[model samples]
Target: MRVKSPESLIAESGADLEGHGLKRTMGLFQLVCFGVGAIVGTGIFVGLSDTVAEAGPAVLVSFVLAGITCVFTAFSFAELGGAIPVSGSSYSFAYATLGERVAFLVGWCLLLEYGVSVSAVAVGWSQYLNELLDSLFGWQLPAALSAGPSDGGVVNLPAVVVLLMAATLLVRGVRESARATTAMAVLKIGILVAFCAIAFTAFQDHNLTPFLANGVGGVTSGASLAFFSYIGFDAITTAGEEVRDPRRNIPIAIMICIGVVTLLYCAVAVAAIGALGADAVGDKPAALSLVVDDVTHSTVGGGIIAFGAVVAIASVVLAVMYGQTRILMSMSRDGLIPRVFERVSPKTSTPVRGTWIVAVVFAVPAAFSSLDAVVNLTTIGTLAIMVAVNVSVVALRRSHPGLKRSFRVPLYPLSPVLGVAFCLYLIWGTGWTTWVQFAVFLAVGVLVYGVYGRKNSRLGATPRTGAAAEAARGA
Candidate 1:
C-alpha cells in the first residue's frame, strides 16, 4: 500500500494547534530562554572538573576550540531552520530534501540526542544533590544510591527523581516549562559569574606554567567534553512551530545564544584554572562546589554554588526533555512513529502521552545506569545528528535552488563544509567505542525503518495523483 507523503502528515499532525484549546503561544524571547536554559547546565557544572583533569591548564584552549566547532555547526542549523521552518529541525529538513527513510533515521538519532541527554543530565543532578547534602547535613547519600555502577554506585534514585520532576513540568505545558527554565537559567548563569569573579581575585600567575602538561591529545579530549556545553543552542531551532516569524527569528536566536553561552564557558574555564591550579581543580571531585570552596576559603560559598548547580541541572532536564517531546511529536505526525506519541492535550497544548513515554525511557538510565555510559551515548548521538544536519543543509541547497531562504549561510558551500569537518573532528575525539556503538545504533534505526517506518510513513504510503505529486515536487 502506498503511504501518504510526510507533507500530508505534517498537514495532519498540527490540526490540534489550530483549534480552541491547543494553541502554542511561544515567541522569540521565550524560545531563546529555552535554548539558554538547556545550554548552561551539566557541561559546566560537572564536566568542567573532568575536562580540567584531562587537559590541565590547557583546558582553557580546549574551550575555545570546542566553541569554534559549535559556532560552525550553529551556522548550518540556522540555514536549515530558515529554509525548512519546521518543528522537527533536521528530521523535517531531511524529509523534505532527502527522503522519508533518511528522515526516519534523523528522528531516531534525535531520540538519542535529546532523550539520553536528559538521562545524562540527571546523572549530573545526582552529583549536585550529594554536594548539597554533604554541605548542609554533614552527610551524603551512599554511593550505591546516589551514583551509577560506573561511578561506584549500583542505582541512582536522585537522578530518577529529577527526570520525573522535569517530566511533570513538561506535561503542564511549554509556557510553564519555559518560565521555569528561564528562572533557573538566570540563576545558573548568575552563580557562574559570581564564582568566576571570586576565583579571579585569588589567581596565582605560577599556576599558568606547565599549561600543556598533558599535551595536545589531552586538550582534544577536554575539548570533546566541553563540546557538550554547546549542543543545546540548536534547541532553539526545534521550536519553529511556536516561534513568531521562524524564518527570521530562528537564525538570529541561535547565533545570539551560541555567542552568549560560549563567552560564559570560557570565563569559567579561565577562572577555575587560575584560582585552584589545574592539578588541584583536576584532583577535586567533579562538583562545582569544590571550585567555590577553593576560591572563598569557606564552606558557605560552596553551599551557594551547589544550590546553583541543582537549579542548573534542573533547567537542563526541563529544556532537553521538552525538545525530546516536541521532536517525537514531529515524528508521530509523520507516521514514522506511532501516532499516539503525537497526541496533544486539549487543555495544555502539549503532547501528554509523548511526555510520559519519554519520561519512562529517560527515567531508567537516570535511575539505574552510569553517568559515563549516558555521556558517551549522548556524545555519540549528538555528534551524529550535528554532522547529519550540516550535510542536510548542503543537500537541501543543491536539491532546491529556487526555494526561498530568508537566512542564508554567509559563505555558501564553504561554511557547511567547515561545519562538517569540525563535527567529524569532535567525533574522532570520542574514541573507538563510541564509534562502534553509534554504528550499531544507526543500523538498528535502519532496521526499524525497513520493518515498519518505510511502509507506514505518510510519505511512502500516500499515493499522490499526477497533479498533487507535481505540486509536492514543486514545493
Candidate 2:
C-alpha cells in the first residue's frame, strides 16, 4: 500500500526511458506533425456528417465549442507534460500527484480510450477505402467482407488489414513511424484545404438559413460528438520521453496541434454545410466526398477526397496505436500490467510485442463490431481521463509550488477548474447508457488492480526486489 511519491515517479520514469533505450529523435516540427497527424482524422472525415445531423448547419458552432473545451484541457496537458516530461501522459501525472491506485485507473481508462479509438478509426478507414475503390474502379469489396455485423457484413476485413499495417509501421521504430505520419498528415491537410477551397465556390446562403434548426440542445450534443475529434491532441504528450527539449516542445506542440486542427474542423464544417445544406450532410458517412463530387460534378473529385480519407484515417490508426503501446509500456514498467508490455525491442527501440498485442486485441472488434457502439465509449473514457488530468494538475501545483515548469496554464486554478467543468459537462451529454458502461469498465479496472496490480506494483515492493528484478531481466 505504499504510495509512490512525485519525486520517485519522476526518477523512475527517467530510469525507464534510459533503461529501455527509446530514441529521442523527434524535434518540435516532428512532434507537431505527430499531434496533427493524430488529431485530424476520422472525426472530421466521417464524424462531421454525424455532427451536422445533430446540430444542422450549426455544426460550425459545435466545432468551436468543442475546440474551446479541448483548449482548456490541452493547457492542463501542456503544463503537466512540460513539468513531468514522461511517456505515460496523464497516467504518469496522476501517479505523481494522486497515488498508485488512481494512476492505475487513469492508465486503464487510457487503454480503453486509445484502444477503442484506434479500432474506431480503423473502421472509418475501411469505409473510405471502400468508397475509393468504388469511385476509382467501379467496384467495391462485397458487403459481407467489407462491413461489420451491425452493417450486415460478416467481417470488416479492411479494418483489420489497416490495423495490422499500422501495427507493422509502429514496430519499425518511432522515428520511422513519425516520418510516415508526417507525410500522411501533410497530404491529408492539403486535401482538406483543397476541399474547402472548392466547396466554398458552391456555397449558398439558403443552405445556412436554418442554421439553428436543431436548437441549442443540438449544438451541445454536437459539441460532445465533436469532442472526440479533438481527443488525439494529448497523444503527443505520450511522446514526452521521445521528444527533444520536452519541457518546451511538448506545450508548444500541443497548442499548435489544437489550433491547427480546430481551424481545419471549423472550416470543413462550414464548407460542407455551405456547399450542400444540412440535410445532404447529415447521416452520410462520405459527406466530404459527396460535397467534392457535387462541387466538381465529377467522380474524380470524390475519388480524390476518398483517397485522402484513406491516408488520414491510416495516420490516426498509427498515432493512436503508438499512444496505446507507450501507455501500456509505462503501466507495465510500474507493474500495473504484465511486464511483456514494457519490453522495448533492442533492434528497433520500440515495444514490438506490445504493439502486436494491441493490434490483435482491437482488430477483432473493428472487424465484427459497429463503429457507433465503440466510438461513444472512446469519447466517454477520454472525457473522464481529461477530468482526472485536470485534477492532477491542480493538486500538483498546490503541493509543489516550487517545482520548475517550462509551461504554465494561463489562468492557474481557473484553467483547470474550467477544464474539469467542461469535461463534466460533456460527460453529462454522453447519456446514462454510456455512464453505466463507464462504471462497468471502472469496476473491471478496480478488480484487476485489487487482484494483480495492487500487490505487484513496483512502487509498493522493495526497490531491491521489484524494479531490480525487472532491470536484471532488461525489461
Candidate 3:
C-alpha cells in the first residue's frame, strides 16, 4: 500500500462525505422566521408557569434581566456567526480559531443543549396535549398515560409523538421543514397574542401589588428559567449554509428574533399575571392552563391556549432537532464524531441518519425522564456554550485580523466580556449540582475523544492512515 502525500491527507481532512446541500437559499425573512420558530416555543407556554412559581410577581423582573443578558450574548453570537458562515454555527467557528479540543467541548455542550431542549419542548407538549384532550372530551388522560416523571406522570406519550413527528419532517428537507416551522410559529404567536389580549381585559392593578414578593432569589430563578426561551437565538447560526448572504442576514435575524420574542413574552407574562394575580398564577392546580381558564371563564379559551401550547412545543422540537442534526453533521464532517452522521441523502438534501439519531436520542428521554431534571441539565449546557461563544468572538477578532466580518460586535471586547460575565452569573445561579453534572459530562466527552474521536478525527486522520490506505489500495 502506498502512503498518500501530506497535502492529500489535509485535503481529505476537510472533505464532506455527506455532501453539504445547503446552497444559500434562505433570505432575511426566512432566517428570521427560523429564529422565531425556534425561540417562541415552550418557554412561553409551560415556562411561564415555572417562572411564576419561582418568582411570584417578581418573575417580570426575571424576564427583563434574562432579556438583557440575552442581548449581550446575542451580539457575540451575531458577530461570530456573521464572521464565519458555516453550517455548524459556533462549533465550526471554534474549530477554525480555538483549536480542536475547544471545538470538541463546544460540540459536546451543544449535544446537551439541543438534545435536552427538544425533549423539554416535547414534555411541555404532553401537558397541553392532555389539556386539549380534556377541553374537548370533558375527560383527561390518566397520569400514567400522560406527563413526565417530574410532573407526576408515568409516561410521556405525547412528547415522544411530537419528537417522531418532528424527526420525520426534518428528514424531508430544509425548505419544506422551514415552511412547516414558519406555519407553526405563526399559529403559536397568534394564539399568544390572542391569549394576552383577552386576559388583559380582566386585568386588576392590585394583582401586581407585591411585584417583588419573591425578592432577588425568586427573580434570579425566574431569569434562569426564562433563559430557556432565548436558546432559539443560536438556532439561526446552525442554518448558516442555508441562509442567503449569511454574513449580512444572520446577525440581523438573531437580534430581530430576540427583540420580537422578548416583546411577546413580556406582553403575555404581564397579562397572565395581572389578570390572574401572581398568587393565582402560582397556585393553580394546572398552573398555565388554569390561569388561561380563570381569565376567560370558558373552557373554550383554555382549549385555545392548549392548542397554542401544542403548536409552540411542536415547533420547538422541530427547530431544535434541526439544529442538533446540523451540528452533528458538521461534527461528523470534521471527524469529531462518527462519519455516518454526516451522510446527507442525495435525493432529499437532508441528513437522514443524523436526524434519526437525534430523534431517537431525545425521544427516549422524552418518554421517560423528568422535565426539571432535563431542563436544568440543558440550562447548564446552554450557558457553557454561550460563554464559549462570547470568548470565541473575542479570540477570533484578535487572532484572525484578516478575516472580514460582515457584522461586528458593536463594542468589541466590552460586548463579548459582558456576555461572558452574564452567562457566568447565570451558570453560578444554577447551583453546584448542575456544575457537577456538567463536569461529568465533559469528562465523558474526554473519554470518548481518548477512545475514538482522537483516532478517527478527520483533523488527525492523515491520508496515510489505515482507512485511507485501504481505500487507495482498493483503487
Worst 10 residues of 2 by lDDT: 466-475
Q: Candidate 1's error at 129, in angstroms?
A: 1.1
Better of 2 and 3 by lDDT: 2
lDDT for each residue of candidate 1 in 1-475, tens digit (9 for 90 to 100): 2323334434553564334223556677777777889888888888888888888889888888888888878888898888766678877776766667777888888877788888888998888888888888889999989987778788899999988899899889777887897788778889999988888898888887798989999998888877877767777877877677777889988988888888988888888888878888787655468877867788889988998989998998898888888788888776778888777887888888889899988888787776667666677678777887888778777756776677887787888788888778878888999889989999999999899887786665667779657745654
Q: Show the lowest summed lDDT stretch of 10 residues, model 3.
A: 1-10
- The C-alpha stretches of model 2 lying farther than 4 A from their native spots are 1-3, 17-19, 463-475
Q: What is the lDDT of residue 283 in candidate 3?
A: 62
Q: For residues 113-182, could you state the per-residue lDDT of candidate 3 as single tens digits?
A: 8987788788878877888999989887888867766667788888888899998998888888888888
State the lDDT at 98 in candidate 2: 73
Per-prediction TM-score to the true structure, in the order listed: 0.94, 0.96, 0.92
Candidate 2 residues 190-293, lDDT tens each? 99999999999999989997879989999988888999889889999999879999999999999999999999999999999999999999968889999999
> Which residue pairs come into collision in candidate 1?
2-461, 3-460, 3-461, 3-462, 4-458, 4-459, 4-461, 4-462, 5-458, 5-459
Candidate 2 all-Cα RMSD:
3.9
Winner of 2 and 3 under TM-score:
2
Ranking by TM-score: 2, 1, 3
Q: Rate the local accuracy (lDDT) of all candidates.
A: 0.80, 0.89, 0.79
